[model samples]
Target: MSKTEVNIIDPSILEDLCNNVTDGKPVNFELPNHGILHIDKLLPFICVYRYSELDFYFARVIKTQASYIIVDDNTDISHLLEGIRLIMSAKFETFLVLECWPISSEDYTTFEIFCPAGKAPSTVKALEKGFKSLNETYPNIAVEVNDTHARYPDQLEPLLNVEESKKTGTLVIGLGIPTLYKNSKTNELYALFFREFYSVFSETIKRAIHEFIRVQTTDDFENYLMFGKTNIDEITLTSDAELAEISEGMSFLLRTTPVNSNEEWTNFKKNEFKKTPEFKYRLISLDSEIEKRKLYNIPIDKVDDPTIAFILRGKRLEIEKQLTMLEERGTKNFRFVGESLYGVIKKNVLEEAKHILAVYPKREERKSKERFNCHEFAAHAQKELDYYNTKFPNLDLTLEIRNDVAGIMVSKSKLLINNEINLDANRCDALIQHEVGTHILTYCNGKRQPLQQMYEGFEGYDQLQEGLAVIAEYLVGGLTVNRLRLLAGRVIAVESMVNGATFIRTFNLLRKEYGFSDRISYYISMRVYRGGGLTKDAVYLAGLIDLMAYLKAGGNLENLYTGKFNITHIELIEELLYRKVLKQPELPRFLERESVKERFKKLRNGIDITELVN
Candidate 1:
């Protein structure tokens, strides 16, 4: 057939060939007139083949459907077909079949190629002849071909094996070309040709076809011949430049495959998280811990984030369980002992011992006060404490105005305050009711419990204590903007320290930028940066913020006093109380006041007490 009469099918047509062939069978054949083709039905049915340069150039069919394709020819046909035939043929298939085949020396000598199928000698010879022909025909086209296997010793084995074909080749050659074919029927013949030629002129045809595809540009071929799809636009086909551009575009597209967008990627990650079983348990554990703590009067630590609260709940559960057990067992023991005959006798004796112990009032253990500049205020605070203590004898209370910090707690001995702070008439009265009335009351009440730990503290006790203290101050109208600012400053300083900024840097920033006084700035910075990065300052602001949120959410003030950091624990406690699973602990000595108005007045107008007391 004339060269013009010879039709080269589009590369895509190979897929059709692969699907049609191996209608389910392993076929092996050789076309001495063509080359070799082999088909094996492995999962996708792999095929291997090689074709002589003459067979490849003159033969009519080139498409197949087998899973892989291996072209073997020694004429640079890659440029002629724009390399589309090789890539497109391999795109759909799992592999590409290759072998080295050659054209007659007398015909041409300008295609240089390499053989990866262990036929380097034959491949080199064919390439030398082909390059000479190509130099003669297209001298302006710069072509340089090297036998890389021989040049790079490390690459030799990898290039020859079909498995390493993808990584080793200058152009990764796939195996079993027919498997990549668009048409299965075409693959049967193609596979036969591949097996037959390799089994026959194995090394020669393998090298020859390799060289042919190497030099051929798909741009020169008709669109229908290269891709099996016809272009209706004759205008697009009219120019060599247009065809070249189209070929280049297609090649670029094949090389760079598009990836999924970010949103899709995020969705994939989220879905993966959902599939994890731990996610469910985390939620349940957090909820359960919160509920249990609320029942036991233990409080959650003041944490801003709900996630952090969840984490702390886990950490505190053990301590809370111990406290609960102590309460349950101790209460039962007290009740049992009281009911026994010997218990009643011993109780009376114990009471006599307590009365003897209480005969002389216990002296305050905190620093003793002297006649200072603010003697009037100190004396007033002392008198108020004595009166409150008398009114509520159950409370263990003492008032001492010294160089102690602001804010009060029923420490083991004293209601302390910094004498340095101006404790005017109004301030002294406020401190008496807020501190002596509320804090002392709570301490005494908690101490009355069979378990001493109730008077002590639990894991999340800080949040409850701080929240209630602030609420007490608010109810008493003593909470000030200055106090709020101090809290905010603490949070800011703590965050800065955590971020690795120095104490000097924080102090300077707050003093100059925030316009805080040197005293305030130094105190705030020191609070956070003290003793190798104390993170305590963060608690004040974090606590106040949480307290506000809880109160705004309509949380009950009395319930806040009940304690427990776990939200679920609080919920459970509330439920239990509703069903009487637990009773509210009585207001401690510090909380009790004859009148709400009087208590409110004291907390509101309470002393300019240094924040340290709380």
Candidate 2:
């Protein structure tokens, strides 16, 4: 018979045939290829059928047999038995079939089919055609038939609703009826049967679809059923599957080792804190020492603060003697002689000159115009200095012009000018009010006290000195954005050089990009970057920010000027001033308020008056 030729018998007829033939006797089915009968009882003569567009086949017994039957066919028997048991009510031990195909050698096929007593042939036809039609629609599928006797009806009910299974199983039985053709050649019959079998079974061909559905549905079902149950302490009903998943998640958490405890978190923060650099200066300790020694007549110990020690050691005895003599001379009035103060002016003169020369080197040997211009500017600066000195005589001031230097300070005899004037108008005013008004006033005030250290200096004084000076410029309206930008540029230039830029790079950038004249740019960059990683440029901007904060808090600029006037001194002065215990100095004879204001106005405006005054 051809492979496509299917025998679609009514399941009821097949069941009746089995009952009549068994009759408590053995039956044997003849095999076309001389195959042996493996069963002896008639009850074992169960029919195995596969229905599909690809191939169709059936096995039958002519006499009573044992518990099983063997058929030679070279086809899948398990799939055939599953489909048969699903439709028919027949019971036998087992059925084995051998199948031969053109592509390979002969192979044995085995199937087990079980059915109840009243199996109808129409039920078989329905199942066979249903599966075959499913394969026709979805070619890569295989049908597995099983007896649903012991299982609940609901199990098979869901499958019946599946359109593929119902339609294909029905089509396979109806379409496979041509296999009984006797005129057909054996090869033609084999091909026809095989083709029908494959078409019907194609619905169950690939396992991937069933596997994927099983995985996804099982997970969702488990989650839906087990969610709250897993958390119930008393239940203890977790499946090994759920426990295994939980264990894997916990293993991942352990591998990551996240910090959870409060102490562990705290330790992490503490470690980060330890990495920060400690502050170099502490205000409390320095203030305490200063306060402790304030009442004593003896000189402050030099080791207490190096900067203070340097200042006191510079002119301690002379300043002390001058102050004592003035107190004794009953010198309620005194006029400053600018020239007499030149001795002290000389101390910083060479340092300032070196700084200037470092910044502006002579390009040509003789009488350079830049050098001459610098000198003319200095001469002009001196005139203003002299004017301040002469005009502020009520404040015991004297004005004198000299070729020496251009910074000022109050001496027993006069307010000194360094005679060297920085032709830069902004720098000149900053120097005047900063050094003269604050430093000079503080000096004369210290002279009133028994201890000379008050006037000499304070520890960590540079920040205070520069800050006060810059702040004074702001008060006198000399502070300019250009000046601040210059300070900021110095910081940037220094940082660049520290990071390994060369002097030429620093100089060129400042001159070209920053618009600084070559002379000024070279000096400023050199001052910051030349001294082997010095970070001094950072202080100006830092000091200005600090001073602005101090002033904003309603700080008295005049008192800050008269206070010991050191960056180091401000904290204590602030305390004293806050407590209202701050003392003022006795008025000097020649320092007139109106004259000082006039001089300040000229100095503030950058007017050169030295030649005109002299």
Candidate 3:
């Protein structure tokens, strides 16, 4: 809510604000000028900044859960702050007033903490240390602490007298910032530098606030991360939706997968394993440059919450790389971009894949009398969807049988099945757990989240997603030795493709060295060599290995089910969940099975990826 343009803050407005603070309600209102007073909660501190024409971006970078007052010097914010101190001090028993002002110093320092002489030494030391932490992230931005003797800086009048601070039990620290994100010559904003500064500096402010609260207040804080903003604004949500829409417009896997897999395999077999087959890709849906421009224009800078800003910005970069990779498909540059996106096959992962292949010889897939057709598998998938729908009515997932798709693949909320597919009864249940239990389950769970990106899949989400799917197959007693060999063979195939091996050579390596049949070798080669040496197939075994280690170290499988995210995102997701910005996700229904629970117990206690080769 905002007020009409006024020369000063109205008395009645102050009264309403005081009442709200006293009653412990959220307070957000705009002042006469372009000033804003936003109090996320009635915390013990407030970050104050006097609005200036030159330093417009300063207020935008201050991110914290603590309340703040941003108004021009023309507005009388002294009375407004006095009212706040009276109520806030009475409520919390102690309050902190962190006031900020611009400095004209041309030194190398970016921030200076000014404190009154003969004041709380411990509080000053904590605040000083907090600002100093910024040096680790940005070593050149020097920060210093000084004793000003006076409560206010030289450029501004005192908001509270020293005696007033003692009486109200409030400690005031003045921050002298250089406004470095502005161009000195043209006086224009340096947008990129400002964004980078905002992402780092805002977290620094929170760390400083956390220090002050610990040294001065009665609250026992655990970590500075808890002080982050829990509320996501409308701008953040809108930007996420816009980006998700753009992401949905393109399918990375479909565009990258070879459309002529069957034809290519037929040609390769007819040539007696002497020739490399040509591959084809799907038509691009969106122009690469136009989509990249749209991604960069999403105004992610307007998002003040530092965590959300960091997430969105990183996602935009990932999407840009993906677009470039798609545009560079069928070229040498495609492999380089793919490596940057999905990462290259590591030495250890390749060694592990080779060891697994050497130890576990290729075995024939057990034949079954009853091989379920596409219609029967679709029926089983529908039953699994129905089970989840019973628990969550909003889980409306679709199962489609299409001729274009090869085998089973879960894309977004829909599960696509190839029309010519016939699943052996022995492996049918495991495939169900892999697709319906893991992929579709995570997608539906992500849909329940407020952030659209969670459902769309986070950057590098494919690794963890496939890892969990493979684990699901094992948990349901469907992880056959043949399946394990196939996963390992894919890794070897990717490593060979990355090492400049020809397709026919890689196929022969798999067939002669690993004992894979001609058909299996052709299939693996087709997947790895599709779209100019894709490296994503390597993640299946690598992710399973890493995920098993994570579980062995006591990481929660339930956390992995929160959404489609990389293993690296576990800590960030925990932070968001703690801050209440993200809700606790629902676990998959398969976890309720007695056998699956036993499997999880074994996994948590001690289970290696090699142990799952049953």
Overall lDDT per candidate, in order of appearance: 0.38, 0.36, 0.78
Which wins on lDDT, candidate 2 or candidate 3? 3
- Of the two candidates 1 and 2, the one with more favorable TM-score, higher being better, is 1
lDDT of 1 by residue, 173-197 (tens): 2221112111233422333333332
The TM-score that candidate 2 achieves is: 0.31
| Clash statistics: count for each candidate | 151, 94, 0
Top candidate when judged by lDDT against the true structure: 3
Q: What is the lDDT of candidate 1?
A: 0.38
Model 3: per-residue Cα lDDT over 1-614, one tens digit each: 23333256777877888777667566888886678888765677888887545366777865444478887665668778877777666657677788877664444456787887656566666556655655664567766778774545565567778676778787888877776666555767878767766766666666766776777667766776666666677899999898888777877788989898878778888988787898888899789999988998898878887667777777787888888988989988888888888887888888888777777876665667888899998888888878777766866678899888888988877889998888788888789889888888888778878898888988888888888899999888888878888999999899888889999999999999999988888999988888787888998888888898899899978878878888988888887886667878777777889998888888888865667854
Instruction: Estimate the TM-score of every prediction.
Output: 0.34, 0.31, 0.89
Model 3 misplaced regions, further than 4 Å = 1-7, 12-27, 63-66, 82-93, 116-126, 136-143, 147-149, 166-169, 178-196, 214-223, 364-370
- Whole-model lDDT, model 3: 0.78
Q: Which residue pairs does candidate 3 place in steric collision?
A: none
Error at 43, model 2, angstroms: 99
Better of 2 and 3 by TM-score: 3
- Tens digits of per-residue lDDT for model 2 on 1-614? 67544333233533443554445323333333333222223221132222122232322211111222233343223333334333322332222121211111122122212222233334333344444454443343333344433211221111112234333321111111222211234423343334334333322211212222233233232211111101111111122122222222222111211222223324434664222111111111122233223312234221122222233433333233222322222122111211121111222322332333344333222221333234454454355445545634544544344433223444432445544433344445444565555555455565443333444443233445566665555545555544545555665665565556765677677766666665556556545432132344545544544555555555554555443444445654543333222455533222344654554444334431111110
Off by over 4 Å in 2: 1-431, 497-501, 529-533, 563-569, 575-582, 585-614
